[model samples]
Target: MTTRADGRKILVVGVGGLGRAVVEEALDRGAEVSVLVRDPDKLARSVDVRRLAAVTVGDGTDPATLDRAVAGVDVVVSGNGAHKRMAREIARAVKRNGVQKLIWPAGGTNAFADDGVTPAYKLHEGRFPGARDIYLAHQGCIDAIRQVGVNHVIWAPGRMTARGARSRDIEVKVDRSAGMYVSYEDAAWVIVEAAVTDAWDGHLVSAATQTGG
Candidate 1:
């Protein structure tokens, strides 16, 4: 069950916590990692911008830029969880390039069988400002993938926390574990794993940090 990204070419979209982790993990595993980001300068502040194999600076939502970026890479992993609007474009690029898989971690707080159409998704909007918009966009991303018939692995982690390290201590469950928390690093490891495998293909995954790890 040890699938690695060694020698593979991957395009990771986003520079958020999870995105950064995914890029770093892919690099460590010997994959040629390219990133699609709005601001290339900001990458140095979050992750080592130098270690990346290629850096495409542009708007990922733009079909032209996205399609070009996806054309050369073997797989695409979108860790830009909030840029829910970019999923459809990414899926289009993947389809055009003949790529079979697109990996993304979406709906962290609303990771459930219902696919975030629950009351909890609504509840977060009040608990946190602009939560509703983010959640809605995420749902749209999911729907777009389905509509486009793109083969993808969408992860809905119970709750992603800023804490913890890349110990590879990940546990995926069938359904929501309401209290489960996925660390950014651990989530990155699994996301990179998804880049090269069909184990979780065409499914919505629920992953979190192993409680006892």
Candidate 2:
């Protein structure tokens, strides 16, 4: 399809299910991919290490590590979970490296105001059981990225059904009518496709499946 990511250098952070998914999807799209993982062995179990053009073994939450990892890559994709500290660090590195775009998940479930920047979750702290921590972390990331003035995208996906769902038939949109449940495989594909295709550069997004879950 002659997507923008063809032969582009893309660096993906986080080595868990989502991180691995982004890596594989970027590869499937013909992007030369590199991964920054804390443990190459652990990553190897999830993805074929040889398929990666380079591997940086370190804590992605560390600025020094990320500073090196972001260098020379055309784009950066992060699926490192929603943690304030990690987000702050990654944002700093991404900003410092001058990477064109930073793509990550907002941990989902946040409804935005008409202004687009204000989230409804902030109005009430106790929206649900144990929601504060997660919402705060997601906001922390949004704040960090904004403070650093980096071009980025923060998306949210509802409940993940299959972390290993086959990587195809994925869709990214706002129609929650399809329901919130998502497959990690498809969710990962959304991030990679966005990065490679250079779409959704500075917005928050909600995800759905191609064929209703």
Candidate 3:
């Protein structure tokens, strides 16, 4: 498949926290943005949700709802949390729709050992017993999406602190060294970049930066 650098018809499933940020970023890039959210009112509270090209409210796990949410979109992004079952369903539906391009969020523990990811992040994973499992579930969703024939790029951000300095100029890694951490704001920036960047496809990207906040 040939790659292009145009803004896209993007449906971002999940509209809470990070998901909402992804939708806003897509809109900022001049993309036709739509979102699938569980609560219409909750989403409407966000300044941008009401202004999106389209918005659908329902459980993203249901095929019928996913069909409605995903129809006619070029890409689907599952920014929902690991515990959110709809994350898997959204991935599957995107593939079933034949829109193979997808970008999803992951945990820092999913990084490849040699991907320039920080050693501290990997150490954090190993230090906690279920850290690997927490990250593995995110990978499992990526695997399921791939099995369904979707081209996916997964993103993981290091420990995010709410410092209120939301800036996008942050560094990301596919490999890490040590002493790396990212802010939630920076993580969202990386996710938006992966969603819109021509270079991001069929890859799992992680971010740990020094400049955010």
Best by TM-score: 2
lDDT for model 1: 0.74
- For candidate 1, the 10 contiguous residues with the lowest summed lDDT are 172-181
lDDT of each: 0.74, 0.72, 0.69
Count of clashing residue pairs in every prediction: 0, 0, 9
TM-score of each: 0.82, 0.83, 0.83
Best by lDDT: 1
Task: Give one digit per residue, the lDDT tens place, for model 2 in 81-173.
Answer: 577677778878887887888887775545353455555444444655555666677777788778878888776776676555553455555
Clashing pairs in 2: none
Write down the lDDT that model 2 would get. Answer: 0.72
For 35-140, candidate 3 gives per-residue lDDT tens digits of 8888888888874555688888888789899998888988787767574355667767887788747787767776656644443335665567777677677667
TM-score of 2: 0.83
The alpha-carbon deviation from the true structure for residue 87 of candidate 2, after best TM-score superposition, in angstroms, is 1.2
Per-residue error (Å), model 3, residue 2: 20
**Candidate 1 backbone overlaps, count:** 0
The C-alpha stretches of model 1 lying farther than 4 A from their native spots are 82-84, 113-136, 174-180, 211-213
